[model samples]
Structures are given as C-alpha cells and as structure tokens.
Target chain A: MSAMSDDDRRAWAYLAAVAEPPCAPLIALAARYGAVETARMIKARKLPAGNAAVLTATQARCETDSASTDLETAHRRGARLVTPEDDEWPGWALLALDQASTSVRGGGPLALWVRGPANLGDASAVAVGLVGSRAATSYGTHVAGRLASGLADQGASVVSGGAYGIDGAAHRGALATGGRTMAVLACGIDRDYPSGHARLLEEIGDHGLVVSEYPPGTTAAKHRFLTRNRLVAALSAALVVVEAGRRSGAANTAAWARNLGRPLGAVPGPITSAMSVGCHQMIADGQAALVIDAPSVLALVEASGHDNFVRSPATPIDGLPPDQFEVIEALPAHGGLRVEEIAFSAGKPVAAVLTALAVLEVKGLVDGSSGVWRLAESW
Target chain B: MSAMSDDDRRAWAYLAAVAEPPCAPLIALAARYGAVETARMIKARKLPAGNAAVLTATQARCETDSASTDLETAHRRGARLVTPEDDEWPGWALLALDQASTSVRGGGPLALWVRGPANLGDASAVAVGLVGSRAATSYGTHVAGRLASGLADQGASVVSGGAYGIDGAAHRGALATGGRTMAVLACGIDRDYPSGHARLLEEIGDHGLVVSEYPPGTTAAKHRFLTRNRLVAALSAALVVVEAGRRSGAANTAAWARNLGRPLGAVPGPITSAMSVGCHQMIADGQAALVIDAPSVLALVEASGHDNFVRSPATPIDGLPPDQFEVIEALPAHGGLRVEEIAFSAGKPVAAVLTALAVLEVKGLVDGSSGVWRLAESW
Candidate 1:
C-alpha cells in the first residue's frame, strides 16, 4: 500500500490532539469522511447537517492546530506518525475496537506515534499482551518474567504497558531473550511517565517498539491510562494477567480484552496474596481461564487461530507397584520422613517399606538422605 | 420410617464384607432381591438365572459369615450397622451414587458402620467436603482450616477423610468452632489407619461422626482409598479441594464429585507450589470453580440446593475523587510509598497528593505511619 499522504497525516495528528479519547462521535465522523476532510470541516466551524454530537466533542480544541509542531517533535525523538493509510498500521488488530460498544469506551485511535524499527502490523500478528498491577508481589514479577521469556522464545512478540512491577518485568524478560516487545504508553512517546522505566523504554524502542496515541508533551493521568489500556488489548492476539490487586488498572485492561472478544487467561497466585485478588476474581467470575505457565498462554493465542501449539500434558503417577506407590504417597510434601514413620504411614512392615523406597529411589520418585526418605522435588 | 430389623442388618453387614466393594453385579442383585435374600443365595452358592458376574464377584468370600461376630464387636465399640432399611441411612445423599455409571465404580454402600451422636442423614443434609493431599503445604492447611471453620460457623457440617495434613486441619478447625465434622475412613471404623489421627477420630466420634464401609478388621489399602473417595463425594453437598499434587487421591474424589453431578470447588495457591498443581488443573479444565474462602464453598453448596449463602462482594476503590483514587492506586501492594514518590507515580502535584492522602487517611483507607503512605491492609 502507498504511504499515507502528508495532508492525511497532518489531519490525523490534529484530530488526535483535539479530543479526549475515546470520543465516539469524533471517531465516527472521521470514519465517515476522510481524516483530511473531517479536519477541514472542523477547522472551518462548519456544522455538517444534524451532527450535533461532533460539535460538542470537538468545540473546545477545534481552533488548535499543533499538527506541524507535533510531527516535528515526534521526528526529533525518532518517532513517526502511523495512520490507517500506512501499510505498517495495525488495522487488523484494531478492528475489534472500531466495532466494540461505546459503553466500553472503545474507539480506534486516529494514529499511533511509534518509535522503533519493527512494523506494528507485522509484530501484532502473533502478539500476546502480558499485563498486571504496578503494586505487584515478587511472586507476580517472577511469573511474569518467566512467562514473557518463554513466549518470546517461541517466536511470539510480547506487548505490555511500560509501567512498574509486572509490566517492567515482562519487558525486561523479552529483552533478555533478544525477542521483540512493544511498550504502549499512556503518556507521550517522548515522555517517560514512569521515570524509573525510562531506560527500559529506550531499550525497547531500540530493539522493538514504543507506542502511544497521545500527542508529544502530553502527561499521563488517571483517565489517560484507562484509555491507553484498550490499545494494549487491541494490539495483541491474546492477553494474560500475571497478578493484580482488587482495584488495579490491569482489571480495566482485562475488561477491554473481554469486550474485544480476545482470549483471556489469568495466572493464579496464593489466595493469601492481596496482589492476586483481581486475578482470582476474574477466574471466579468466569471471565478468564486459569493459566500457570507460558504453554497455557500460548494455548490461548493458538485458540485465536494464530498458530498451533500443544503443551505436553503432565504425566500422572502410574505403573508403580502398590508398595512403591504407597511409599511415595506417604512422604510429606516439604520434608523427609524417617523409615519407621514412612512404614507406619504406608501401613507396611519396615522391611517392605525399605524395599519400596529403594525401588522408588531408582525411579527418581523418592529421595532417601540422612536416613530420612522424602518425595523427590520434581515429583 | 421404621428402624432396620436385626435380620436385615446382619444380612447387609454380611454383604458389605462379601465383595471388594463397588461390585456392580452384587449391588444390582441385592437391589433386585432384598439384602436377606441376596445373602442367602450367595451363602448357598446358588446364583439367580443368567447372573454369572455375581458368582465371580462373591465366590471367594461367600463361605465366610462374620456378621454375628462383627455385629457384637461393633456394639462393644459403640458402632452400628445402618442399612437401607434404617431411618438414618442417608438415602438421599447416596441416590446419586446408585444412578451413576458403573465405569465410575459408583455403587451405593451396602451398609455403613457409623459411630457418633450425630445422625448420618441429618448431618449430610448440609455438608461440604474439604479434601486434599496428606503432603500439603502450610498455605494449603491454613486456607483449609479457615474455610472449614467458616463453613461450620455457618451451620454447615464439614466432611473429610481421617488423615494427616489438610484433612486433619479441616477436621480440627470444625471442632474448634464447635461445629459438626464427619470423618469418612478408608479402613474399618474400629481401626485407626493414620495412627496420628486416632485421637482426632475419637474426638469426631464424640462430637460428630466416624463412618466407614469396610468391616471391623479390614486395613487401609491404595485401592480402598480410591473406593473411599466416592463416598466422600456422595456424602457431601459440595466438595472443595485445598491442595493436591498431580496425582493426589483428592483428584479421584474430584472426579467422583463431577461424576455424581455434585458442585466442585478448588482453592488457588502459588503456581510455583507443586502441591497446588491438581487444583490449578481442575480449575483450568473447568472441572471446579475457583473458591477462596468459606463463603465461596458455601456458594457451591447452595448451588446444589442444600442452603442459601451470600458472600459479601469486595469493596472496590470507588466513590473516591480522581486525585485520591490515584494516590491510593499509586501505593504498592505490600509496602508504603513516600509522598513525593506517590505524587510522581500518580502524575499529580506533591501538594495535591498530600491532600488526597490526608482525606484517605481520615476515611481509614490509607495508613500513614512512619511518614510513608500505604493502602490499609483491609482495603
């Protein structure tokens, strides 16, 4: 496809800055008439036949024209405007947003300001969004990192917000594996809202992508992050929540994923951990499937018709002789038990218990050390 | 309803010990002809016409009749044989087992050896089974204890196996709350399979019930535990697994619950914990709902038409102004954040953040001890 015309690009940039997203009326107007024509109508203060909703949506910022300056600032920061007219735009990924209900506050972005060499449309074809709470636990970060690395190793790109905690860990995990990742920001592409992650965002921009719908110099706010979440969900084939508190922003993203009909998976954590409350709630509400590892996340993506993946099913205990299996089951989950204790627990004679333990040890199902027998860690 | 006659009780006891249990053909024969007639036919080595399966199932134990001595021993031990003719036989609870497919090895027990003040049918009218691995983690036990205590507090009987770890914790929790708890054993009612829980079983017998399908001298075996699991599912309105390894016996009980059309629930734990693998698998496979507390378990029981329970929905971060809500969200899950850090994270001024924190603290939403602000633990 031909590159977006200069007039269309400038018009899109202007429209993006004029309204607070997601302005359903403005988005609808732009779709009916081309971005360039819509911008001309708005600038001339012309009322297009009985469309009063657009006037109310755009009146405040209609006279403002920072398109030239915004484009210049983006170019200086190594970012460029990508409209639906551009071949690199992720139109397929964002189609769901255009069709979603207004109650969900879902509306496609006018254009994306992207900073990276990777093409957004190509990267999104096999992408998964890993999102969760900024106030996350160590367990959450560990799982997020491991899952992101595994997904990247499978040749799938990872998408996430460039925030603290779970999001940062996901970005770092993908980067560590030298795989592609896209960081969609709530603020301007030039600004690092979570300043601590500035360097991480720079690294992502260098190797993958840094995207935002906000214009240059726009600051992050509560409402903007809520708006930005929809894009993260729209840009990925599937979404997995690693961890989240009851009121975490990740929950908003999850709602958006559901609204877009995306396959959603949530990682289960200790019920005692407050940070995992949202994930547990999602699973309990039947809004998400429980996912423990990367293979499970890939399975969700595969369900969306991106690729075929089959996680090797865990092998259940089988084929062990009765006594040997009893001995393995008798050993405590955390520590070793004495031979006499094992015998008592298994309801077998001490000699028989010893024989069974020996067989189990050879099969790598039990460990007998310091005269105490325990189930092998891997078992 | 009339109490079971002596002859019928003796015949049921004899039949219960004649087969290895869950013998579909023998159970069918007993149902077709009365228990007394079925016992007499087996003792005379005479099969009903066209019933070769019954002969193969009962031929080994047909010659031995311990009903007289077994009844005397049970009387001396404060146990009684409650048969289908008895008023307290829990017929409603066992109806599903009789209707289930033979492939599940689900045949109603011929007779129950019960020792307790509580009536079997009445106790099972509103019961929830809390089952899991003998080798469970501290997290699993803690959750199990809390859930059991809460369920008991709500006047629902807690049911579990008389074993160590999660089962012991659940039984003790119910006892501590002065609520009824039933222990269904894999061994004979007179025998203590897990010797460590002998005193716990005695406590349950004193306050609630100890039930078993096996004869007085029978020992616990691997296969017996598998058969015993079905009864646990049948006796309870719902089953909640606390923690289970990949091949824990609790998984078998879960399968039985599903087979019998009983509502099933599973408590979530850290994905890293091997003990929770079976629970996560159950939830992922859609075989069990994700239950976190006693109310959630109660919801499952209520779903089965046993009782009504309503868990208080968690209060999400709402009704707060944007600035205050942002400040609260900025605080980390496990620790506090400094005012300046909160301000930076929330993209608000330091003064605005301080004001929001003050209002939040007054409302008991945030803790501001040691000059750092954190969301209150309860929140």
Candidate 2:
C-alpha cells in the first residue's frame, strides 16, 4: 500500500480532533473526498456536494487547528499518530465497528494515538480483552491475574483498560510473564488517566503497546471511557469479563463485544459476592459463556470451528464401581474411620462396605493399616 | 381414581422388591397387564406373549416373595404403599420417565412407600428439587438453604435426596420457615440411611413427606442413590444443583432433570473451590441455567410461559448521566472525599465533578455538608 502523505496525516488528525468520536458524518466525508480534501473543504466552510451533516458534526471544533501542535506533543511523549492511512492501522480488527448497528454507540475512531514497540495490528489479531470493575474483590483480581498470565504464555496478547483492580492485575500478570499486553486508555496515550498506574502504563509502553483514540492533552471523562470501551472490544478477537458490579463500565464493553459479534465469556465468582452480580446475570441471560480459566477463554475464541474443550478434571476413582466410589467418598479427606462408620456414612450395608474397602485397599486407594480405613495419601 | 385393593398393594410391594429399580421391562409388564396380574405371572415363571426380559430382570428375587411381610413391616412403621391404582399416586409427575430417552437411566418406580401428612400428588404438582454435594462448603449450604426457604415460602414444596450437607440444609431451611418439604430417600421409607438425620426425617414425615421406592427393610447403596435421583427430578417441576464436586451425585440428578424435560438451574460459586466445579461446568455447557436466588429458580419452573425474570437489583444512581454516575462510583462506600479527590478518582474535571455533586445533592443521593461529599446513608 502507498504511504500516507504528510498533508493527509495532518488532515486526518484535524478531523479526529474536530469531532467527538463516532461521528459517522465526518467519517463518510473523509471516505468520499479523502482526508486532505475533506479538511480543506471544512476549513473553508465549503460543502462537498450533499454533506451538510459533516458541517454540523464538526461545527464546534472545526475552527481550532491543533493538528500540528497535537502531533508535536505526541512526538515529545514518544507517541505517534496512527491514521487510517498508516499501514500499521488495525483496519481488519476495527472493521466490525463499521458494520455495527446504531444501538451500539461509538463508531470507529478517526485516528488512533499509539505508544510502544508492539504492533497494534499484530497484537490485536490474536488478543483477548480482559475488562472488569475497578472495585474488584481479591478473588476477582486473583483470577484475572492467573487468566491473563496463562493467556500470555499461550502466545495471545492480553488487552485491558488501564484502571485499578482487575485491569491493573491483568496488565501486571502479562508483564510478569514477559509477554505482550495492550493498554487502551480512556484519555490521551501520553497521559495516565488513573495516575496511580502511571509507572505501569510506562512499563506497558516500553514492552507492549498503549493506545487510544483521544489526542494529546485530552483528559479522561465518563463519556470518553464509554467511547474507549468500543476500541478494546474491537481490537480483541474475543472478550472476557473477569468481574463486574451491577453497574460497571466493563458491562458496557461486554455489550460492545456482543454488538461486534465477538465471542464473550464471564468468569463466575461466589454467588454471595456483590462484585459478581453482573457476571452471573450475563451467564444466566445467555449473554456470555461461563469461563473459568484461560483454556475456556481460548475455547470461546476458537469455538466456531474447533472441537469441544472439556473442563472436568479426572479423579482417582473415576471409573470405580458405585460401591467402591461411595466408600472412597465416605472416607474423610484427613484421618480415618472404622468399617461400620464408613458403612453408615456411605449408607451401604456393612458387607458391601467391607467388600468395597477390600477392593479399594488392593487398588491402593485406601489404607486399613491403623485398623481404620482412610483415603490413600496420594488421593 | 379408584383406591388400590390390599391385594394390589401387596402385588406392587412384591414387584418393587423383585427387581433392581429402573426395570423398564417390569414397568412395561405392569402397564400392559395390571400390577397384581404381573406379580402372579412373575411368580408362576410364566411369560406373556413374547415378553422374556422380565425373567432376566427378576430372576434372583421373584421366588422370594416378601409382599405380606414387607407390607406388615411398612404398616408398623407408619409407611403406606401407594400404587398407580391409588388416587394419591403422582402418576402425572412420573409419566415423564416413561417417555424419557434410554440414555437417561432409570424408569418409573412400580410403587412408592410414603409416610407423611402431605398428599404426594398435590405436593409434587408444585415442587422444586434441590440437590448438591454432601461435602458442600458453607457458601453452598447457605445459598441452598436460602433458595429452599424462598421456594418453600412461595407455596412450592422443596424436594431433596435427604442426605447431608446441601440436602440437609435445604430440608432444614424449608422446615425452619414452616414450609412443606419432601425427602425422597434412597433407602426404605421406614429406615434412616443417614441415621444422623433420623429426627429430621421424622419431623419431615410429620409435617411434609418422606418418600421411597425401596421396601421397608431395604438399605441405601450407591446405585440406589443414582436410581433415586431420577425420582427427585421426576417429582419436581424443576431441579437446581446448589453445589457439586466433579463427580457428584447432584450432576446425575441434573442430567435426569434435563432428560425429563424439567428446567434445570445451577448456583455459581467461587472458581477456586472444587465444590463448584460441576456446577460451573454445567452452566458453561448450557446444560443448566445459572440461578442465584429462588426467583431465578421459579423463573426456570415457569420458563415455558411467563415474562422474563430479571435479576439485576437497581442502585440509586441507575438513571444518572455518565458524569454523575461516575462521580457516585468514585465515592468510597464509607466516609467522604474532597471535591478534588473525587474529581481525580472519577477522572473528570473539577468543574464537571462539582456540577455532578450539586445535582446529586439535590437528588438526596449525596451529602456535601462539610466540604466533603459522601453517598447518602439511604443509598
């Protein structure tokens, strides 16, 4: 593909700053007349045929030209502007946003601000977006970390927003494993919206990628995060909600994932945990698959044409007869019990329990050495 | 329906004892030729036209007739035989067994030995079976108990296998609420397999019901529990698994529920707990709905014709604009924060945070009396 000219790059940057993201009219204008020409027409207050809506969409910021300054600020921060004209643009990944229905808010970004050595296109091609609550519980953070680490180890990049709790844990987990991770920001790529994660974001930028649609000097706002969520969902091959409250930004990302037709999964937590309320509801409503680990996440990603992934772990007595299995179940995890106690616990006749114990002893699944039967230590 | 004759009850008692349950051939024989006639034919070793499987299924016990003695024993223990001829028989509930696919083991029982004040047919008409691991954790037992109590309070009978852990918790929960509960036992109605629950069983028999297909002297065995699980599923409108290990008996009951065309639900738990493995797997595989409360269980029961049951509990800031909602979310659950701290936490501008705080104060959702904002106590 031909490289974008300097004029086209500056034009796209101006268009990006002129309107809030998801400006369909501006996107259409640029597509029809090219970024450079579209910028010229808007700057001169001239209409390109029948595109009056573009003027309305860009009316507020069209007169302010900060394209050059924004680019310079981005360069100073070691970030670069990645326009649709750039060969490194994740066009394939964001293509779904173009086809999304109106109900799913936030269309594709006009241009992205990227920082880091990792390639956005390559990383997103086989990535999993892991998002969740900033007020997540310890259990949620633990599971998120383990899942992110496992996913990274399996050669898939971990993607997440750079917030605290689950998001921070996921990014840290990927970093701990010396693997690629992408942090999509709600604010400018040069700024850490959650300042507490400033060093973490820099670490991610040094080894992975930090990306955003907002330009330099743009601060994070509630609406911007909503807009940013669409990018996280768009970039990933699949999305998993690690933990979420009833009303959480992650839920919005999950919605975007669904709207984009990306496979979605939710990790289950204790029914008593308020943090997991959204996840249970999503699974119950059939909006997401119940994912417990990294393999389950991979299963969701490869669900279309792959063989089923079984999650049941085998036990020592997997194929034992009912009587023997019951005897084994009756034995306490620790300590030992007499034959009659075992029989009573298993709800079986003494003779049957004795026979089961004999066979179990032979199979090395139980021990009767202390005149009381107990599960084998290996068990 | 007509009352079953003493002779017919005796015949059914004999048939129930002669075969290991789920004897499809004997069930067919009784359906084709009445229970009394079928018993006489089996005793005479006479085969009906082209019916030979019955001989194989009953060969070991057909000649050892215990009908008279078993009935006497049952009567002494306050247990009464209820055959298909009896008006109190739950034929409507068990009919699903006759229509079930062969892959689902266990067929309809020939007769039930019941001891209780509750009518079997009436109670089974509006019931939910609750089953789970005998080695359940406190969380599992807690959820099971709460769900049982709620279901019972809603005029639905709670049915369970009457074992320990989750099952015992369910039974106790229903009883504690002065609600009806039925214990479908793996052993004889007259005997307590888990002797520790003898008093609990007596209480259930006095106020609810104790049901079993096994004869008075019969004891519980591993296979009997599997066979009994089918009865639990068949007798209820829907079934829920509260918690279960990988090879749990509750999973078998859930399968029976699915096979019998009964709606099935499974409670979610911490992923770190092995006790919740089976439950999570069932939900992941779409074999069971994720149910966290009694209403969700009721939703499963009425899923065929009812409005969707929504499980989300709304918060005070539910309808707030993005800025206001984010500000509310940033506030600590306890105590208050200064405007600058709130702004930083919410990732919003100071002016925007002030505007949201003012609106929230007017709505009585936030308090700003001491230059510090906090969520209203009512919230």
Candidate 3:
C-alpha cells in the first residue's frame, strides 16, 4: 500500500498528542470526515457539536503544528506512527473494538505510536494478554512468568502492560524463553513511565514491540492507564489474569475483553491470597473461566494445536506390547470405531483387539466411550 | 416411633456383614423383601434370582450365624446398629442417595454402624463435606483446616473420611473450633483403620460421629473406601475439595457430588502444586466453582446467612450524620428502593438523599445499580 499522505499522518499525530485516547466523539468525527478534514475543522473552530473547552484546549495544543515535530522526534527515537490505513496496522482486533462498546467507554485508537522491531500485524495476530496486580505476590509473579514463557515457547506472543510485578515478570519470562513479547504502555513508548523499567522496556523494543496511543513526550497519567487497558485487551486473542484484587485496573481490562467477546481466563491461587480475590470472584461470577497452565489458556483461546501443547504427544506406541501398539494404530484420530471394525482393520481377532484396547485405555493412550474406541485427547 | 424390632436389627446386622456396601441389587432385594426375609432367603440359599457367585459367597459368610455375635460385640464396643427403619437413621441424605446414581455405583449403607455422641440426623442435616488427597501438601492441609474451622464456626458440621492429611486436618480443625464433625470410616467404626488416627477418631466419637457400614471387625478394604465416598457426598449440602491429584479418591467423591447435584466447590492452591490438579481440572471443566473462603462456599451451597458471615453487620448508621444515617436506614435489606422513595422515607430532599447514597456507596455501606440504591453485599 502507498504510504499515508503527509496531511493525514500529521492529522493523526496531532490527534494522538492532543485528544485523549478513546474520545468517542473525536473517533466518530475522524471516521466520518477523514482525519485531515476533522483536524482542519477543529483548528478553524468551525466543528459543530464539539466540546468547546476541549476543542479550545486542543486547538491551543496544536497551534504550533507539533505534529511534524512529534513525527520527526518519533523517527529519531526509532518509533513510527501506525495509522489505520497502513497495511501493517493491527486492524482486526481494533475493528472488533469499533463494533463493540467497552465497559470503560473505550474504543479503538485513531493511531498507534509504536517503537519496536516486530511487525504490528503479526505481533498482534497471536498475542495473548497476560496481566495482573502491580502489587503481585511471589506466587502470582511465578505463575504469570510460567504462563508467559509457555505461551511464547509455543510461538505465541505474550502481551502485557509494561508495569511492575506480574506484568514485568510476564515480559521477562517470555524474553527468557527466547520468545517474542509486547508491552502496550499507558504512557508514551519513547518514555518509560516507571523509570526503573527503562532497561526492560529497551530490551523489549529491541526484541519485540512497544506500543502506545500517547505522543512521545507524554508522561503517564492516571486516566491514561484506564484508557490504555482497552488496547491491551483488544490486541490479544485472549486475556489471562494472573492475580488481581477485588477492585483493580486489571479487572477493567477483563471487562473490556469480555465486552469484545474475547475469551478471558483467570489463574486460580490460594483462597487465602487477597491478590487472587478478583480472579476467584470472576470465576465464581461466571465472568471468566479458570485456567491453570499455558496449555489450558491456549485451549480456551482456541489456538491451533492447543491439544498438542496440552500434553506430550501420547506415550510412544513402541513402549507397548506389539498387539496393543497395533490396536492403538487402528484407532482413528477423528472419530472412534467399534471393536469389530478395529479388529478387522488391524487384522486381529475381536477378542484380541478388545484386550489390547483395554490395555491402551488403561495406559491413557486410547479411550473408549460407549461401544467405540478412539485415540485419547493427549494422543 | 417404636424401637426397631430385635429381629429387624439382627437382620440388618447380618446383611451389613455379608454384603458389601452399595450392592444395589442387594439393597433392592432387602428393600423389596424386607431385611429379615432377604437375610433368611440368602442364608437358606433360597434366593433364586441372586447373582449366583455373590449369593454363594454370602451364604458361606453367613453359615457361621455371626449376626447375633456381631451385634453383641458391637454393643460391647459401644456401637449401635442403625437400621433404615430406625428413627436415628440418617435417612434424608440416604434418600437423596437413593434418588441419584453414583459414579462408583455406590449407595447408602443398608444399616449404618455408629459409635458417636452426636445425633445422626442432626449431624448430617447441615453437613458440608471437606475432603482431599491423603498425600496433601502443607498448603492443602492448611486450607482444609481453615475451611473446616470456618464452616464449624458458623454452626455447620463437616463430614470427611477419617484418613490422614486433609481429612484428619479438617476434623481436627473443626474440633479446635468446637464445631461438630463426622468421620465416615471405610472400615468398621469400631476399628480405626489408620490406627494412627485412633485417638482422633475416639475424640470424634465423643464430640461428633463416627459411622461405617462394615461389621465391627471388618478391615478397611480398597473397594470399601470408594463405596464410602458416596455417603460423604450425600450427607453434605455441598462438597469442597481442598486439594486433590488428577485421579485421587477425592475426584471420585467430586463425581458423586456432581451426580447428586450437590453444589461442589474447590479451594484453589498455587497452580504449581500438583495436589491441586484435579480441582483446577474441575474448575476449568465447569464441573466445580472456585471458592476462596467458607462464606463463598456457603453462598454456593445456598445456605442462609452466608452474606452475613461474609462480613460483620454494617457499621451502625448512627455513626454517620443524622441525614446520611437516615438515608441508609431507609434502604431495605430484601431489595433496593428508588431514590425518591428513599428520600421521602428519610424525610430529606431528593438531591440530599442522592448525595448521602453516593457517600455511603463510597464508604462501602450502600450500593446503587441502575437507578436504585441498596445496602452493599459486604455491608
């Protein structure tokens, strides 16, 4: 696709800098009249039905035409503007957001300010959000890390906030596994908000992607965190909450995941851990399914070959007696077959086939329900 | 009701000794022909339709005419035979068992052999089953103990197998809280199977109940434990599996609980704990709800006053200013009232009532959903 026209890119950059993310009216206006026209109308103070105070403030912020300067600085910082028109834009999840209303009234970003080596589209296609308490316990951090590593090992990207505790652990775990990870930041990708995580963020940008909706010079603000949650929820196929208190920012992300009809899972922890209360509550309320491991999370996400990750491929048939091994071989993967059919297919007597199937079932290499036998789930 | 006739008691004693528990055909025969007639036919080999091998074995076991001797010995051991016809029989739960098919094809004891101070009916009336792996970790044991103690503190009885690990801890925890507990033994109630738990079992018999189906001298057999699980599931309004492996006996009890439509809960431990695999599986499979505390368990069981147990009664409204206190006092407990209705009742302006409600909500004393306000769940 052709590169975005300079005017459109400048319009989006100006919007990203001045308008708060998920400003529904601004999103609607920009979509109705292309960003360039919308920016023009707002600048001339001729846009109808605009919030006067917000419009006035936005015009003052954009008077200097900082969009060009911001764009230049972003390029200097190795960051790029990902507009909706870009072929490399992560569109499917954002389209999903556009079609659904968010719990926090959040919607798709007009443009993503990204800094990273990974392609936005591919990075988001297989992303699974791993989020939880900033004040997570060791148990929560350990579980989050394991889940992230496991998902990454299976070639899926782990997506999370680039904050402390569980989020930081998840990113580190994925990186440690030599797998891709992305951090969707509440602040500008160019500026690490936590300061302590500057090196960590730098490593992520080098190895994976760092995404934001805010301009490069923007600092992390309170409402920005809540608004940023929608991006985290939308970018992933599923969101796994490692640990959260009853009322938490992570829970808001969970709500967005639900609003967008994404599969949401919560890892269970000891009932005594207050950190796990949100997860337990979600499970109890039927809002989230309980997930214990990476494979289970993958299974809920309906990722291809989840069952392959669920367990080691069935124990080698070579370990079994020749008869049992032959019987297992006769069992179809797609559907079960009856004893006589299996026997006929395996060139064995019905009685021998029955005995062999029994042994295989006991070994959990095969399963028989009703009168038919099939390869077990692990197999 | 009049006491059970001596002949009926002796007949039940004979059946208990000769037939394994949950022998559905045997139970059906006894129920159809009465225990006295069934015992007579089995002894004389006149029961023509009986399973030939089972009947033959039963006849051999009864050839010594051990019923009277067993009854005498049981009495000497301070135990009593509780026939189905006896008023002291725990019939309600067994009736529920009769209605539901069990996973292990288990049924209620034809006659429970009991040695305890607590009444069978009362003890089983409000019982909650707390069970898990015998190879429980300290985490499992600690959680089990807490759940048991919490349930007992609220006047609910805990029922569990009288085994080491989780079960023993549950019973001990209940006792420590001066709450009633019942130990449903796999072996004869007269002989504590583990031997190490003898003193503990004795304490249970003194303070709660020790019940079994086998005759006084019968050793605990492998099959008996599986059969005994049904009773534990049936007796409880709900079953909480604190921790279990993928295929432990506790899973069997969980199946029975499902078959019986009992509300089943699992207290989650760290996902890394192998002991919690079965619970996580159940929760992930939607077979069990995740519960974090006793009140959560009770809420799942549909027990009355569970919300009350969740937190102390709301702080007195008097602590608030007269206006806000009046608004809080106006909100009904059963269902929420509208703002105008609340205002009129509180003798305050509608705006002032709304302000008070908002403050109370932030204070965690009230809740408003839609347009109506009510006392918060925790309050």
Q: TM-scores of all models?
A: 0.76, 0.76, 0.77
lDDT minimum window of 10 residues, candidate 2 chain A: A304-313
lDDT of 2 at A64: 98
Q: Which regions of candidate 1 are displaced past 4 Å? A: A1-11, A24-41, A47-56, A307-379, B1-8, B24-41, B47-52, B307-379
Off by over 4 Å in 2: A1-8, A31-34, A101-105, A304-379, B1-5, B27-41, B46-51, B101-105, B305-379
Error of 3 at A298 (Å): 1.6
- What TM-score results for chain B in every one of the models? 0.78, 0.78, 0.76
lDDT of each structure? Answer: 0.84, 0.84, 0.80
TM-score for chain A as predicted in candidate 3: 0.75
Q: Tell me the alpha-carbon RMSD of every candidate.
A: 28.7, 29.7, 22.3
Q: Report how far residue B154 has shifted in candidate 2, in Å.
A: 1.2
Q: Which residue pairs in candidate 1 have backbone atoms (N, alpha carbon, C) closer than 3 angstroms, thus clashing?
A: none
Candidate 1 residues B219-290, lDDT tens each? Answer: 999988988999999898899999999999899998888887788999999999999999999999988999
Best by DockQ: 2
